[model samples]
Target: MALNYDEIVGKFDKYIFNTYTRQPVAIKKACGAVVTDVNGKEYIDCVAGIAVNNVGHCHPAVVEAIKRQAEQLIHVSNLYYTEQQALLAEQLVNLTEMDRVFFCNSGAEAVEGALKLARKATGKKEFIAAEHAFHGRTRGALSVTHKEKYRKPFEPLAPAVFVPYDDADAIREAITEDTAGVILEAIQGEAGVIIPSDGYMKEVREICDETGTLLIVDEVQTGFGRTGKWFAREHSGIKPDIMTLAKAMGGGFPMGAMLAREDVAANFGRGDHASTFGGNALSCAAALANIEVIKKEKLVARSNEFGAYLMKKLKNLNKDYVKEIRGKGLMVGMELSIKCEDIVGKARERGVLLNCTSDSTLRFVPPLSITKEQLDRTVEVLDGI
Candidate 1:
């Protein structure tokens, strides 16, 4: 018999780690903003692989680039340089206005690198992060992550202080001479798209300058036009000492990077940090192609335009449970008076995949390439729900 969803899920139940709370559908293929399940069900993928598919799924350019690179050089050690890595690094440095780039395999790794770099540069061991912040799952990243449940299991992590988001005064009060850096998300993605107030980031930058502390901004979820800019920090017009990027960096391919200015980056010498498979030719090709698509298609502008459209449509929905609608670019979120897990399940059954984060927030991180018609359909499905 042909493979089915139940059989596949059964295999996962038996063999895979029970770490993720997965949805019921077993996706067979995805393209643009739609996914097809094993049972032949089609869905408007509002998740966009959790904001990874910025250029859309299996984009022809990204696919072709990966194929071409695989045919030439797929993997290479950091001891030696590959043209793909060189090209990609230069492109990243140019786009981010950073002096250097450190490649990694995931957002967690990027956060780890950024943390390590900040410590090395500042000769301090403590980090100050915002409450409800989520950097990643690794020990160092988790240390700064503000969720008690996630941190409780992984106790005795690194030293970090949690303060209120969008509150510069709390951060200033928390920082001490031992504070290596202040790590923050430009927009709190896992915390339900908590956008900072105007000048908050700039105020933090000034404080960091005054105290001689490094500022590390985690753009893992909001970068690559997720928030209508190449990076959300751009909106605040303040550059951090270090920045981490991932999610949409590779046109749906798994890749991450930590970037820093020349002076701050110079503290870490060669061999201080390295990733064996980081910036491998194959991943670099996908990332390079992904960036090209974002530029050629002007997805940043599209994200800004469509994001306003999506938020406007959502604000008009006749749902009493809606507490708030917020986001920048396509990274929209709807905070409900009730828990959103049930709403997510209901949305999935109706062909629009939704993500429920922070328990009560419905996060919409669809691809930047999604159409206005698709956007309308997504809202209509939610309205029906």
Candidate 2:
């Protein structure tokens, strides 16, 4: 049975929630950094499923692990002890400084868990987050997210204060007795891949230490070697009390987790929090395989090298519309003076799939497995535009 793109689109219009303004092409399959649409057209995938396919689409090891686990045990719930879940938690704790992990289903759930953990541990009511920082869309996550448009419709969100990003002084001024936690994205992803100034994270760490405020860093989009480092916060040489992760954690499987220091994690007692399908065997197995692939392949170093190459090629273009080129590792963004929606459409026509964020910023989050040659070809396409 041949699939019909038009029929699928029509069905989506009729049945799916009107949450996303989707791209015209319907992806049928992907491998490495290339995706084939239902019509059999291939495009160099720069979006990488919005940074979810860090190890690349259908990585053999990850697929094998998922298959093996699925055949044995896919779901036994969190109520029972699963070796896969326990091993995945151990792998996560080994990779990070955090002492414990709470698994969930998405980045939003991880942020939600972190918020609840912070409030419970510190016994405080308010949280301080940076302007332009995007955490997630759930109620607690939405409250800390700085964008007004996303937060406007759902008014009366959880109590939170917003400060200018990278402003150490403003953070100092904002922190008070009521502040339970200071949440921030090490590099602002949804807000145009904004990177903070040198010493900004260090200063924030000091402030949190002095004020008894828990620092929670959201690594949902930047983790799993998407950045040069294992975690973006490692670039600053500072550790947050809690870190939220998801995007690349379970390969292509839906998964999220909040890693916290021992004392903070201990705040939650038995039956404090649990997700029915949070740490299922399949997701855990896939995650373990994902981590193994990243470590064994040394994708972190590759991201740094290829990311620099891509940035250099982009900067050399010196396009009139290019306002700035900023980002860390493969998570680069080219901010343009004009609206970039048209440019994105043009790129898609040229067989290069790109994404636009914050209206004018062209986001590039290609798979860590993308080749230098593929990236060079992508640059050639952009050069023509």
The TM-scores, one per candidate, come to 0.99, 0.99
User: Candidate 1, residue 173: CA error in Å?
Assistant: 0.9
For residues 206-301, what per-residue lDDT tens digits would candidate 2 score against the true structure? 999998999999999999888799999999999999999999999889999999999899999998888999999999999999999999989999
lDDT of 1 by residue, 1-385 (tens): 7788889999999999999999999999998999999988999999998989999999999999999989988997788889999999999998888899999999999999999999999999999999999999999999999999999988999999999999999999999989999999999999998999999999999999999999999999999999999999999999999999999999988999999999999998988999999999999999999999999999999999999999999999958999999999999999999999998999999999999999999999999999999999999989988
Worst 10 residues of 1 by lDDT: 72-81
**Local distance difference test, each candidate:** 0.95, 0.94
Cα error, residue 149 of model 1, in Å, equals 0.7
Worst 10 residues of 2 by lDDT: 1-10
Q: How far out, in Å, is residue 302 in model 1?
A: 0.1
Q: State residue 97's C-alpha deviation in candidate 1, in Å.
A: 0.8
